[model samples]
Target: MARKVLTVLLPLLLCVIAFAGLLLLSIPIRNVREPPSYKYGIVLDAGSSHTSMFVYKWIEEKENGTGIVSQHSMCDVHGGGISSYAENPSEAAESLVECLNQALKDVPKKRHPITPLYLGATAGMRLLNLTNPAASASVLSSVNEMLSKYPFDFRGARILSGQDEGVLGWVTANYLLENFIKYGWAGEWFRPKRGTVGAMDLGGASTQITFETASQTEDPANEVRLQLYGKSYRVYTHSFLCYGRDQMLKKLLAGVLQRHSTHPCWPVGYSAKVFLKDVYSSPCTSAQRPPDYDVSAEVTLSGSGNPILCQQLVSDLFNFSSCSFSQCSFNDVFQPPLSGNFIAFSAFYYTMDFLQKVMKLPVTSTAELRTAAKALCNESWEKLLELAPSQKSRLADYCASATFVHQLLVQGYRFDEHTFPRIAFQKKAGDTSIGWALGYMLNLTNMIPAGQMHFHKGTDHATWAVLLLIFIMIILISLVMIFCFARSSKTQSAI
Candidate 1:
């Protein structure tokens, strides 16, 4: 009975031992070096005005202590913002997905399995208050549902706040600075001293300001401070609810009509907001039109032609602009409680004046503000001329020792000094205006140091590969040990 029982149990014992031996043998032989690569992924930065999507493949780089770091090279899809999606979520998603599908056409089928798609929304969706909660929720829900139906690997989507948007732009801009420019300077253009640097990002529905210590610090994390300006202020983010170009124009026109019984300047019942929006939103370009309502009209009205009327109009516009900020207490323009308009214009005018007339920033304006502003404008025009590729070689020869930079400084102008001179000028030239100055101050206060921000958060390819290899090796070693144990059990049973 004992011998029979031993025979029956022997096979089972041997089988277990064999499995252990196989695991042991497989352990050292397992392929532990090569790691799997996760295929490319798509990232979407959705803003109030526009939505940009990029398909990126990771490239790994090795550092001494950091092991391997991965960065992405993008293929982008351009479109409108969440507002577009708000009208029709599925439609918007379909358009975006189609763009993504098109982008992937060049990539081989074998690389498709591991790709990931991530979406992030900012400004537009975030600003939706109780008034439009249903619309906003519908927009987001539709986008989520549509994405869920797709077969491609999806990470997820998130809607960020205004302050968050500011931070993102800051991170993106600095990354460009680190990767492309590789140098730091004061103000819009390069200056001698490296003072505090400010970044003001004006979006469709909101604006953000980021401030940082100009000089690179030993501890990168100690650099930026992000806090709103006033009690009602919500950090470096000041989102003027419905103060976009279209909205502002509408409000201005409505206010003008309400105040004046008849049309004050233009024809009666002329809706600047509606007219402008229709013209801009149309597929047709200004060049294809009569050019009746161009910047020239604004320029003529604002400039020397009719100073009193222009000033009144500008003041009214300024007053309207001031109302957007909840923090402002002023009512009458330049009266009891000073209007933000008064502050904004005076500040900008004075600062430019100081830079051109007093500081003599370009050394030619004798530091006169007006002269410098004019010079800056002229310099911008010349720079545009130089930028034309057709005139490149000839223009270079004729450009001569004529310092366009100095010429710009002498005019007391603050335009055409940077890549986006218009934006720069808008901020710098209007530094004195309460609204512009407030924007600048907001930007200055929120600046952060390099390295403190992160654009991506995930395990790099190398680390993931190493972890996978280690896991496989442990499994193999267990199998080998089981095999060896099985053979010993059979020998013992034979004895």
Candidate 2:
């Protein structure tokens, strides 16, 4: 009787084990389809002069679980700075929220839960005086309260320092150059030998220059060298705190009026306060309008009146003229002996000349660059022109300076002629804000891991193949466990 029982039990166990093995084999063969819903994401690029939000949708592939993603159109949200929002955070938040909500009108309600939102504030927010404990707390409180009312979940938001922003811009610029310009659709339009390229991004609050040297071989994993400059001695970057067109103009005006007692304006120190009050309080100002171009031009020229003296002083201080600018091949036509005003004027001329004539950037000649550096000087300037139509007005000084810098770079001009270096401005096609937004989203989603992957170690295709094999084995083992439990007679009986 015992022998009979053993025989029956053993056979039954063997059959169960066989069934489990079969179930395990079937697991990998199950349907592998793309998710029914799409994942959405948004990025808020909060710049000093303005803020813009971009929204995108994720694309999934059924075969290998990988596919290209795309950004939805007209989902951008733009508004004034935190300072502007400080007075009425709710109102400011609503304005931006409305824009974002409107953008989602076309998307199905089911996909709303999958959408993620991120906010990053650059130069402008970083410069805020958060040291005053009371004011700082209020600002934070206001911002948090405002964000809580938004629809999508906020992943994270922070004020990035000028240096951080500069580096990010560099990373962003390079990513665009490699992914969009070199390999994707841009390659079809124009085929330029991809190599070491430099980028100069002049924003409203600051200017960032990045130098990246590409590898000689076609290795995608190349090391990139980055240098950032900001306001302080942060030589890697230079942030002229309040050195943007508007702030600089205000200082220039104040200085000029203070210096000349014969001015037709108000009493001593009167005009400066009045101008500042008007700038901060007036509703007529707008980002598009900026400040008065004529006033700004006069102040900047007057403020920097002795280029020769300034250059001499800088040369003496640094004790390296050749390294500075003297060793360059181009003439120092922008140098002093000429009044500081002429030097400043020449700088603008040189920058424009370099951009338009030398490298030949497309939008260099646009009215924006052609206007006085300080045309849109304050926050009010931005608000007044928020809804107005675009207009073109040439600011000869700014254009000239930009051109002059371009010329110096192309011609290999020496540094003794000027205090700064003239670098090239390379413009690639499809360089819109949307393209950047899309690229960033794709990177975050791991759609194009190749773009974000840094090839520091010598990990080649062989390494990846080995890794993939290991992963597959691990997955297979996990499937075997699931199948074994499902096939067991006792477990099935219990269920």
The C-alpha TM-scores of every prediction are 0.42, 0.49
Q: 1-495 in candidate 1: lDDT tens per residue?
A: 786556555655655565565444333232346754434555665656666555544322211111111223333346667655655766656656655665467334666555556667755666553336777777777777766665556666767655555554543333222321222221011212222233444445444444343333233322334421111111122233333333333343444333443223232112222244333322212222344554323211111222233224323433323433223312211111111111111122333433444334542223333343333323322452444445433222111111222222222122222321222322222111112212221232232222222222133446545655665565566556556667767898999
Candidate 2 matches the true fold with a TM-score of 0.49
Error of 2 at 145 (Å): 3.2
Give the residue spans of candidate 2 off by over 4 A.
Answer: 1-38, 62-70, 74-79, 106-108, 130-137, 179-193, 213-240, 260-274, 278-389, 392-431, 434-495
| C-alpha RMSD of each candidate structure in angstroms | 19.4, 17.5
Cα deviation in Å at residue 467, candidate 2? Answer: 26
lDDT of each: 0.38, 0.39
For candidate 2, write residues 76-107 as lDDT tens digits: 45566554555554554565666566646745
Model 2, position 307: C-alpha lDDT score? 28
